[model samples]
Target: MKLLTVLFIGLIMMGPSDPTFKVGEVAPDIALPNMNGEIVKLSSLRGQMVFIDFWASWCKPCRKENPQIVADYMKYKDEEFENGTGFTVYSISLDKKKEAWQKAISKDSLIWTTNVSDLMGWKNEAALRYKIGSLPMSYLIDGDGVIVAVNPRGDKLEKALKKNRKSESWFKSLFGY
Candidate 1:
C-alpha cells in the first residue's frame, strides 16, 4: 500500500514532456515517404520556408483548414514574394488507413504539396516525437530551418506574409520606383 501510494504520488508530480521542436529552435531533419513513394528529407529544403502540418483525415478541424492551406500555398508557391521568400507546405498525415488519407487529399485538392504518412495513426514516431496532442497543428520554418511560429491561424499567417509583402514593396520603391 505504501509503495503504491508513493508511485502514485511520483506519477502525479511528473509533468508531461515538451515537444521536440520549439520556436526559434532548429527543426530536426526528417525523411519520410510521400504519397508517390518518393522520400523527402527536411534538410533538402534548407533555403526555403516550409510549413510542417500535422493532421489526420478524421479530424474535422483539419478538414476545415485544408482549403485555407491550399489557397495560401497556391498564392505563395509561384514566385519569391516581395521579401524574397519562397514557401512550401509539407503535410504529414496521421491516418492509419491509406484509402482515407488518399481520399482526404483528393477531396481537398491538396496538390503541389508534399503529402506523407506512415499509416500508423497515433503511433507514428514523428507524431510521438512532436508530442502532438491535437490535430491540425503546424510549424512555420524559416530558410535557416528555425521554427518561426507554431500553430499559427490562417489570419495570423496572412498577416505575417502581408508584412513581408509590404517590406518588399518598400524595398522596390527605394530601389526602382
Candidate 2:
C-alpha cells in the first residue's frame, strides 16, 4: 500500500500541466517601462481588445509589419468589438538599445501610446513571460483579457477585428445618413 501510494503521487506530479498561455486563455498582465520610463500595465487596457505585440528595432520582418499594424490601429482603435468596444496595441520591444527602439518607433509612425520593453533584447522580461519564439509575434486579446487570435496580419487582422465586431442593424449597414 505504501509503494502504491508513492507511485500514484509521483504520477500525479508528472501529469500534464496547464499551459501558461494559449488561444482563449486569459493573457497574463504585463507591466513594463515605456520610452519615457513610465511603467505601463497590460491590464490597464482591459476594456479594449489589445494586440500584445513583441518585436525589436533591428528585426526586418517586424519593420515590414509595422505599416499594416499602424493602419489597423488607426482604423479600429475607435471601433467596437464583441467583447470590448475600443482597440489598442500594447507593443513590447526586445531591443538592447533604447535609442534605436525609440528611433524606429518614430520612423514607423506607430502612434499608439502603450509601448514598453525592458531593453534587454532577446532576454526581455515580457518576452520570457510570453515564451516568445520569433519576431513579429502578436496576440489579439478581447476586452476581457482573453486571447482571441494570434498573429493575424494585414487583411486577416482587419478581418479578425471585424469578425468580433457587434452586428449592426440593417439600417446602419444599408445607408449613410
Candidate 3:
C-alpha cells in the first residue's frame, strides 16, 4: 500500500510527456521530403515568415481550405514582414502516396515552392513532431521561427499577417524601404 501511494504521487508530479508550444514560443524545426523527393529542412527558410500547414489530400475540409490558403499565400508572398523580407508557405502534407499529394497541390493551385511530406500519412515525421491530432492544422511562424498564430485561416489569418507586417507608413517613418 505504501509503494502504491508513492507511485501515485510520482505519476501525478511527472507532468505531460509531450511539450506544447503556445504563441511567442520558438517552433521546433522540421525536415522532410519536398515535392521533388529531396529533403527540405524547415530552417532553410529561416529568414522569411512561414506558414507551416499540416494537411492531407484525403481530408475534404483540408481540400476546401486549400483555396483560401492559396489566396493568402498569393496575397502575402511579396509582403515585407516586421523582421523578414519575404513570406512563404511551408506546406507539410500527411500523405502516404506521392501521386495524391502532388495531384492535390496541382489541383488546388498551391504555387508555393516549399510543399513537403514524408509520405507516411498519419505517421509523417513532421506531423508527429508538430503533434498534429487533426487534419488542416497549421502554425504561422515569424521570421525567427517563433509561432505567431495557430490554426489561423481565411480573414483571421489575413488579419494576423497584416498586423505583423510593416506598413508603408511605417517604412516611410523609418526612412522608407
RMSD of each: 7.3, 10.8, 8.9
Model 3, runs deviating above 4 Å: 1-19, 168-177
Order the candidates by lDDT, highest first.
2, 3, 1
Q: Point out the higher-scoring one by lDDT: 1 or 2.
A: 2
C-alpha lDDT of all candidate models, in order: 0.74, 0.82, 0.81
**Lowest lDDT 10-mer window, candidate 3?**
10-19
Clashing pairs in 1: none
List model 2 lDDT by residue over 1-177, tens digit each: 999977754543332233347788899989999999999999999989899888888877778889988999998899877789899999999999999999999999989999898899878888888776666677899999998887775577887787787653233466641
For candidate 3, the TM-score is 0.83
TM-score, cand. 1: 0.78
Per-residue error for 140 in candidate 1, Å, reads 0.3
- Indicate the residue-level lDDT of 33 in model 1: 79
Candidate 1, 27-88: lDDT as tens digits: 88777778877888777777677788888888777788889888888887654544336777
State TM-scores per candidate: 0.78, 0.82, 0.83
Candidate 3 or 2, higher lDDT = 2
Supply the global lDDT for candidate 2.
0.82
- The model with the greater TM-score, 1 or 3, is 3
TM-score of 2: 0.82
